[model samples]
Target: MKEDKRPILVFGATGRQGGAVAEALLKARWPVRAIVRDIAAPKSVALRQAGAELVEGSFADLDTFRAGMDSAHGVFSVLPANLSETEEVRIGCGIADLAAESGVAHLVYSSGASSGDTPTGIARFDAKPRIEAHIRWLPVTATIIRPMIFMDMLINPAFGLSEGRYTFFLRPDQSMQLIAVEDIGKFVAAIFADGIRFSGRTIKIASDTVTGRQLGEIFSEAAGRPVIYSRFADEVLAANSDLGQLAAILDNGPLADHVDLAAMREINPEIISFRAWLATQRHQAFDALIGSDRTSHSA
Candidate 1:
């Protein structure tokens, strides 16, 4: 956005969150250098095609990260959720150290809304707080963004959307903030564009907040059929401890009241809501899931 053309080095560019950031940065005319594992991977190739300077590397490889961050303007850090807490923290913190040591101007770390100083007994959520703490000790100007639950999860067939029923961590009347993956990039781009305003702040972002019942209504309207919505059944939760812990968090945890739609709209005005995401970007996926077995099973 200025006369300087240094790129913002982006990690996890092949995945959902990172890819969104990369695309948004490119659209904003900011140069992006994406660190990827497989240079020939489809997502990696696509990044190159989209004007990203792809650098082959892994998160654990310090040499590769140092090289990529060298002389870069900023760094965007996000680790895979499937990783263990120790590994996630190590890589996340290491990136911050590298960014600061590399003289990067700004660092943006993608953390979960439910993540905070208190442990939620969830590994993925707990790891971020550790990473955040590490960044606090560094000299680099950093913005920690806590993104609410993703709207994309609702479309997963395992969640029962393919069968016209969606089970989640909320009661029909209770509300939870949901963010579109597409919106994550916009928020991140804004944070990078203005370091002075967002640095040293932990801002939570969400495009829309909806109750479970509202989700059903939106899905039904989009699918042209009835879609039931309900909280995770007690039996289901008890059967899976991980899901059970997450559901518990939703009931009473950091996730309950994190999103401020008014503030988010101010930062990224084009924030997409659940209905808009379903009607637009996710329509194909929704159609695929609903049409999966619609003709064979008429439940």
Candidate 2:
């Protein structure tokens, strides 16, 4: 029998969630192998500098993906969210098939919070359910993590946060879960350590729960200026079908189904609160958006 030589192969290792997972795995001294379309990409180079072994590959290439996963102890799988219609399902099935064929012991798939038995009516959010179903039939032991809306997403340029105010899909007073990207890494590393604890289990991971008013307060504190939150204006959504459709789904679906904060704390005791995260991240985040520098004092 050939001795196992490959490390845990993490797909989408250059992106937010997978990158965080790879960093945590390396910090725990677990060998991490990352698949990247371009090893020369700055993010990929950063992963390499952080001690990740890189495999040049794309999601469309099953052969390279199989080689990357061969005899791996586990795999951290996260796909980019750019696919059209149900193509996201196709890519996920392809990865799961290759992992099982390569004899991977465990697979951790990162899915979205919007994925549920009932469709959310949003293509992007609803795409994961099909992929989750596909992973079920594979011979590999798989753990699915349905993560809440990323706190960092609030700052995306398209979200109007960089402008004066903010508009999101959630209604005021409706509680929704949010997780820091770093916490996803912490949570996933825990899963990788004891796949038995997580295998065959689909878990929702979150760091904090907050209402729209709470989002406003945090934004105000982080920006050192008042910021208000409201449902996207009907006219706004009507103009931008993509954003509008997502907003509609959030309004009608279980998008705001609260995650048990107590359970998440049990899994990651060090989960940061929204206020603390804002304070810690404000400077860099502001810099990215406004090209202005601000000083952050240690709390």
Per-residue lDDT tens digits for candidate 2, residues 1-299, read 12343478888788888888998888877889999999898998999899999999875666778778766889888988888646788888888888888888898999988888887667877889888998998888999998888888777776566665667766787667789999999999888877788998899898888888788877666665666778777787899878876776566655657777888888888887777777785467654653343335343
- Tens digits of per-residue lDDT, candidate 1, 170-235, equal 899998898999999999999988889998999889999898899898877777789898888899
List candidate 2 stretches off by more than 4 Å.
1-6, 158-163, 234-244, 287-299
Looking at model 1, residue 260 earns an lDDT score of 65
Give the clashing pairs for model 1. Answer: none
Candidate 1: what lDDT?
Answer: 0.88
Worst 10 residues of 1 by lDDT: 290-299
TM-score for all predictions?
0.94, 0.89
lDDT for model 2? 0.80
Off by over 4 Å in 1: 292-299
The top-ranked prediction according to lDDT is 1
Model 2 residue-pair collision total:
0
